[model samples]
Target: MDTEAHVTERDRSSDPDTREGEGSRSARFLDAPWRRPALLGTACAAFLLLFSTFVMQPFLIPSGSMEPTLRVGDRVLVNKLAYRFDSVPQRGDVVVFDGTGSFVREEPAGNPVTGLVRWAAAAVGLAEPAETDYIKRVVGVGGDRVVCCDKRGRVEVNGRAVDETYLYPGDVPSRVPFDIVVPQGTLWVMGDHRSHSRDSRDHLGEPGGGMVPVGKVVGRADWIGWPVGRWSSLERPDAFGRVTAPGPVGSHG
Candidate 1:
């Protein structure tokens, strides 16, 4: 009698209705209107965070420094893999870079946790760009001589004058004159609006000679991703075609 009683209790506990009832209750709990949507939203955010971190990043233009090339409120899509494989930054290519030692003295101190969140937010174009981030056109590359204002008041690279039609209207190539050779593995960058930009020319007196190390480059600005009216690619200027590579033969090799 005792054995029969125990078996009857065990069978009741293992009933399909009992197990299914527990599972259904759990499912209902998870299916709360807010909870399901919240879960999906979190999954989407995580995907964007990863994609923006390693693939491409949307950088917001904070000011008019880039002017005609990149206007205020423009979200430039930085191609992170542009130079990741075997390529290097070339003259006339607009690039986004971290200017820690080149532009800013040092990185700002911040809590690591907060900083990570802020950086992730900026990566996906959800927040403002970091203060140390900068975007500019490559005027001179490694081993090239960069000079401001030739006889025609145009910037010169490798002894050839560059016709900058992209310059902000009425804005000169550079208001402050400078002449320097770009260091190997570094880049001399400038903004389209030379008058208002504080670019490599502005940092000529400081260390690195206003040159941004190629290693600091985040990526080339491939396209304008935001503002439906301003959707277009940032093409490399043909003016650089005339300028030869630093070495002999006047070739791109």
Candidate 2:
């Protein structure tokens, strides 16, 4: 009788219903119809995020520094690969460059976790860039003489007068006079909205004299990607047409 009672107790404790319940929970996930699609969506989103942060990023215009060309809130697609093969940024090309140690006064902030979030947001064109970055037109390349207010009140590159029809309407080349030759392997850049922009000109008296190194360039702004109404392709302006290349020994004038 005691043996039969022990057997009954073991059967009760090892009931099949309890075992089935555990099995069902384990199988529930496998049986879900939406699992595959959800996983695929997450994978695609992650891939896009990675591609944008480390590869090609979309930068938003927060200020009117590049007005008439890039407005406030406009998002531009930055081509990070453009300068990887080349060693310099060409004149008339709008470029996005890292301003951490060179241009801006404050250094960039954020820990690893926060930086990843910010980078992901910037990749999808939803957030502002974290680093001190600037979008400016390349006025002078390495060894080019870039001077302001020539005889025609225009900015000169290599002693040639550039017709800046692309300048903001009624805007002059510069109100703060400046004359400096761009150093070799560096770039002198300026914003379209010269009056409001704090470009290399603003830093002329600072440490680097506002010249950005070729290595600091992040990418070229290839297109305005957001705000469908403002969508457009960014092209190198032809104003540098008559400008001559630097001489073998560099520009003497």
Candidate 3:
């Protein structure tokens, strides 16, 4: 029996031309000019949308209402999960919330296309938020006596005077004096720039008693995220530390 020559021909795949052709095909497939950039952009957009909806949201200060602490052009990062747990907003924490029925008697329905555009712009802090949204600092929460213009010209919560170091220069604690107890599950909020803000105080006579329901709060303004020079973390001041909890109803501290 003659043994057959067992030499196997060289593999075609090992040929230099075949290898070059394969490489060229791969290069052509990967070199689609727009694919990588488009994918990256889509991923980035999805991440931003998720972050803005459930993690942190970017909010553009639309007016001087928050003033010294949050300038009109300042962009703040709101912690949407701040109060999602058992905890609630505490005194001195700046918050953003819906103003419907409290600050806004009604929200007019707008064109869906326009609404979507507005939402996109607001999401990136490029435009002012909807008219039904407002921002202010929590002065009292859930059954705290919030009094304006104490004997020392300062606001008081639960009978303790607040040292408003964040108040706008030359701005009093409140020019429109009033006294009220923050109802249960609600917040008594005010703008640092008392004179320029139309906050809960402005709607005292309205249906909601100028109180924002805790349920309506969108998030806590935690930091100034834009205008590199203005970047800063927002901290809850010690002013509220001295404030006690709710006392007897209709009692003044």
Candidate 4:
């Protein structure tokens, strides 16, 4: 990924002067932000664009992959700085990531015009995420042993069972059985609505072993921001509080 490209794009969108690369609109926008032509809507869009670029970004839920916790069309507030200052992602945190290599081999090439259109709309939570973007809950983080269904049909991490109260009703922890140690700097993530989500479980046989690298994470989802009535905090469940991270080979015994 071109890190500088994303940074440059954010700079251009946030600063009207640097927006010259965007075409003639920069000239008109700089003069009177809301005066002639496009009116108030243009100014509002610019403010939202700036906010989304630097602060919390609104992400529209594209499917029922997260279900009861996050419904379709629910706009989520992604805290961009949550993991920026040497903060590591923990188990039970919801995160959005670029799933190119781990979730899918690579992002398919698309026309620049169409891709631009999608990016513009998706920026403000009006459209689905880009082809490689995905959101899921972190089940196991770097070096933890993750297993499915220990007698009670609950997922276990580092030998502790996880009580997933957020899971969609009637769904089991996992229908398929597997036991694997999450690699360092990667996450074993899954969706709340597991049956409907194609997360780490589905990619168990693929390269990277379905672990999403911490570097690929965009940010942690802290709240749901839209639909007026459906707003709420996406809390980190406490079920993992007693669980422990993996220790060196001989340390545990």
The CA lDDT of each predicted structure is: 0.89, 0.85, 0.89, 0.89
Candidate 1 lDDT by residue in tens digits, 1-253: 4656444346654889988998898899898789989999999998988888788899989989999888998998999999987899999999999999999999999899999888888988878889899999999988898787788898888788999999999999988888788888999999999889999988888988899999999999999989989999999989889998776533422
lDDT of 3 by residue, 92-203 (tens): 9999999887888889799999999898778878888898989999998998988877789999877788999999999999888888888999999989998998888888
Off by over 4 Å in 2: 1-26, 248-253
Worst 10 residues of 1 by lDDT: 1-10
The list of candidate 3 runs beyond 4 A from truth reads 1-31, 250-253
Over 72-186, each residue of candidate 4 has an lDDT whose tens digit, in order, gives 9899999889998799899999999999999989899999999988887888888888979999999999989889988999998888898999999999999989898888899
Candidate 3 global lDDT: 0.89
- The order of the candidates by TM-score, greatest first, is 1, 3, 2, 4
Pairs that collide in candidate 1 are none
By TM-score, the best candidate is 1
RMSD of each: 3.9, 4.2, 6.7, 14.1
Give the better candidate number (3 or 4) by TM-score.
3
Candidate 3, residue 217: how far the Cα is off, in Å: 0.5
lDDT of 2 by residue, 4-87 (tens): 644434654378988888789879987788987999899999998878766788898888989899999999999888887554
